[model samples]
Target: MTIKNQYGIVKIAIASGKGGTGKTTLATNLAAYLSGKQKIILADLDVEEPNSGLFIRVERKHEEIMYKMIPGWEEDKCTFCGLCQEVCNFNAVLNMGKLILVYPELCHSCYACSELCPEGALPMKKQRMGVLKHFSNGKINFIESKLDIGQEQAVPLIAQTLDYVDKHSENESLVILDSPPGTSCPVIEATKEADKILLVTEPTPFGLHDLKLAVETMEKLDKEFVVVLNRYGVGNAGVEEYCKENDIRIIAMIPDDRQVAELYARGKLVYKKSSAFREALDRIAEYILEN
Candidate 1:
């Protein structure tokens, strides 16, 4: 299947309700498949544990540290009025009469504490949270962001990675975002700007349960999304039945193959070896291009 340039840059986010659901598999192979015919920008937005770079062979072109703003306490300027602590809704600031403590992890970077400080004791300062790397191999441009160990928030890093993708992608490029799993703040931040979301799930009972939560999340966000059933032949038809009952579209079903697993274990792309996997990717690419 060939993609026409009529759609401009189509941002497609591949996400799942849980981990180990082949979210990275679908994302990596789909980007590789599409890169054969067109320019593809594949971004791994799973900042906490990004692993999409494992499957693709690309040279790192750029790397940068990502930072988030947190309030810095200036004790000399403080009047001990306790206003900063009161204005912080996240409990990041604490007032202890003689001294104030600021917890960076608890800070949401809303700037409320800094902006509302009456004595200018609280100033917003940058704190390192993650690192973003840009990689490429001719047709495929890969971007991955990884959060620093012990970083509590993924939304800020994910947002920064998306900004990088937006700034670098061309108008005709197909941008595919590999989002973090689950229906949480990180996933929402990763897929918020996507033109369409593809939720990958298995055929098991757990898959169906989490898929329901993911569907509900997309519905609340009013985002257009479809399902892609991974490990199709291993589990029961519960996920299929649930999708049918809900009138949700299943765009593609990747079959369960041991060779696929073997290739994946070796950090290889299954589409290069398995024809069935390639065919499923083609279906997904066609759906993306036609829509």
Candidate 2:
């Protein structure tokens, strides 16, 4: 199926401009709320630091290693020609007359050089970047990805996970994707095809600044977007002011409570059936269901 299809399901992305903005907190709660109401897939696309699993206990299903295809050289088939170098746009392939160099770090793994090699000297190779973890929390399908340390690119892993979700979701279940904190490539990758994005933020200056960055990204992406303010009274009112000035909707505001932090530290969720966070989240969730 095409990535654009969205499998006739609402794909909601919970993201943030900076870390420590309660991104995963909101995501986990939203996923839990939706899972009980209907079928759902909760995917943590923050490959570098996947912490959603810490909040929700799940049985680990079988996982598989995720690989990326890079280019390799077969020295025996080399003709010393410059076709490989000419076709490579990433500057990953280098031809120095007698010696040819392949820089894996600079490679985009586009395979242009390998495909155009006149002598068929270059072949594609796989590099283990990370693993795709499959999990199940009763009715909810949980997907959390972990990037191997020092891996430069996480967009590929995020793409692979999205593709896997599209292929695996045979029913019209909501896909709640928990994205990395930031407006970087990884965040963009996670929210690129999302049906709706909830930008989580606090009430401080940094929160407003980073939310602006995330808003800029959403404007460029041109997707349906909203904002969720977490820990409302802990910081200044900068976030609310910014949203009001920009005409952006504040979908929900979760009050700052010490009990929430204590529960989070103990690996417990704060958004329960009677909690204010869950009530606000349920209202925001209705947008997906009603739309």
Per model, how many backbone clashes are there? 0, 0
Q: How do the predictions measure up, each by TM-score?
A: 0.96, 0.90
Q: lDDT tens digits, residues 1-291, model 2?
A: 111233567788999999988888888877777677777789999999899999877789869999888877888899888898898888888999887898765777888898888887888989788999888866778898888887768889999989988876756777889998898899999999988899999899989999999999999989789999888888898888888999999988888888877777887877773378877777777666555
TM-score of 1: 0.96
After superposition on all CA atoms, how large is the RMSD of candidate 1? 1.5
**How do the residues 1-291 of candidate 1 rate in per-residue lDDT, one tens digit apiece?**
445456578899999999999999889999998898888999999888899999999999999999999988898999999988898888889999999998887889999989898888889999989899999998999999998888889988898899999999886899999999999999999988999899999999999999999999999999999999999898899998888998999989999998988888899999988888988988888788765
- Top of the candidates by TM-score: 1
Computed on alpha carbons, the lDDT of every model, listed in order, comes to 0.91, 0.84
